[model samples]
Target: MTVLLTGLPSAGKTSLATAARAALLAAGHRVEVLDGDVVRRELWPELGLSPEDRERNLTRIGSVALLLARNGIITIVAAIAPYAHSRAALRAAHAGVPFAEVHVATPVEVCRRRDVKGLYARQARGEITGLTGVDAVYEEPLTPDLRIDTTLEDVGESAARLVDFILHGPVLSSPHGGRECSGRF
Candidate 1:
């Protein structure tokens, strides 16, 4: 299964992914988190934040998630994925696979306040531009499997909801087995 968590920066996508990964692992389920910042920094340092580049980044991440998911790993993806078309493309690519789109619907104002990485501060200082949900664009999901606002729900509660969805949600059985896949994370 691949769970794609999308939202503005500092909207708690990574926190939710980490909390859910811990619980899922505690339940003896194989899980992996593909965080967008880490992936971009480590794998695609040359990529800029242009729309095309962002789409390309998302495509690459989706490919990796699909590869791991096909092998029975529950892959949790935390990415801004600002473009609706890009996210839709990923979903289309995952046809017949267990895929869930989670929208971290935390408002941009709240995210700016959280600003875990000082992105908002940098933008405010004119050190950066085109920040998603600010100067750039973040096309909200038309219909997502789940929608969460971090300001309303804490990490533990959000993670519980995600874990429940993974375990009990309607997911197509993999070739490897049923809900309990038999492979790596």
Candidate 2:
């Protein structure tokens, strides 16, 4: 299964991914997180933050996620993935795999306030270009498998909710299929 987590900068995408990875690992699942920042820094160091570079980066990550999922490895991807078309293409490319899109819907104002890296401030001062939710637009997910509003939920709660979603399926039941459940937050 491949869980593609999308959101604006500082929306807790990486935090949720890390927590989910830890929870999944504790549950005996083979899990890995492909974080966009880490990937950009490590794997595709030459890729800039331009539109073309974003596409190339996403393509590489999507391909890697597809490959890992096909081999029964649970892959969690934390990326901005600002373009709807590109995300749709990624979904199509991973057809037949258990792919879940999780949108971490955090407001731009909140993200800017929590900007640990000062990315939003940099963009405001003209020090950075192509920053999502600032200069560049982030195409919000129309219909995501899971949607977490970070403003309303803490990171631990959100991560646990996502873990529950993945383990019990979209309907929110027990992983062992013991009883049907409902009312997932």
Candidate 3:
């Protein structure tokens, strides 16, 4: 299975992925996290933040995720994934595999305040441009498998919900706290 956690920078996607990974590991499931910033810095440093560049980057990440999933590893991806078309293409490519696109729906103001990587601050200082959800375009997902707002719940609660979805299947929830689970474990 492949789970893509898409959101703005510092929107808690990486932190959530880390917590969920730990929980899944503790439950004895083999899992791998492909964090976008780490992957870009370590592997694809040549790639820029342009739309085409972002699409190429995500395609590469999706390829690796698919490979891991085929080998029986659960892959969790934490990425900005600003383009809706790119995300849809990745999902379509998964075909028979279980693929879940999870929108980390934290507001931009909250993310700017968190600023875990100082991205927002740098943007503010004019040291950067094309920052996703700021100057750049982040085409939000219209209908994701799940939508999580970091402000609504703590990381532990969010991680538990994600782990449950991974171990079982889709756990649908509304922004206001209603939940409905479906599919087999």
Give the candidate number with the greatest lDDT.
1
Q: TM per model?
A: 0.91, 0.90, 0.91
Which digits, one per residue and each the tens of the lDDT, describe model 3 over residues 23-140? 9999899999999888888898999888898999999999999999889899999999999889889887787778888888888999899888899999999999999999999998
Tell me the lDDT of model 3 at 74. 91
Model 3, C-alpha of 10: deviation from truth (Å): 0.6
The residue ranges of model 3 lying beyond 4 angstroms of the native Cα positions read 171-185
Q: Please, what are the lDDT tens digits per residue for candidate 1 over residues 1-185?
A: 89999989998899999999999999999999999989999998888899999999999999999999999999999999999889888988887778888888888888989899999999999999999999999998867777776776578887887788789876533221123211101
Q: What pairs collide in candidate 2?
A: none
Q: Quote the positional error of residue 33 for candidate 2 in Å.
A: 0.1
Instruction: Estimate the TM-score for candidate 1.
Output: 0.91
Once fitted onto the true fold, the runs of candidate 1 whose alpha carbons sit more than 4 angstroms away are 172-185
Span of 10 residues, lowest total lDDT, candidate 3 = 176-185
Candidate 3: lDDT over CA atoms? 0.84
- Residue-level lDDT tens digits of model 2 in 76-176: 99999999888888877877787777788888888888896899988989988888987898999887777788877677788888888788765311112
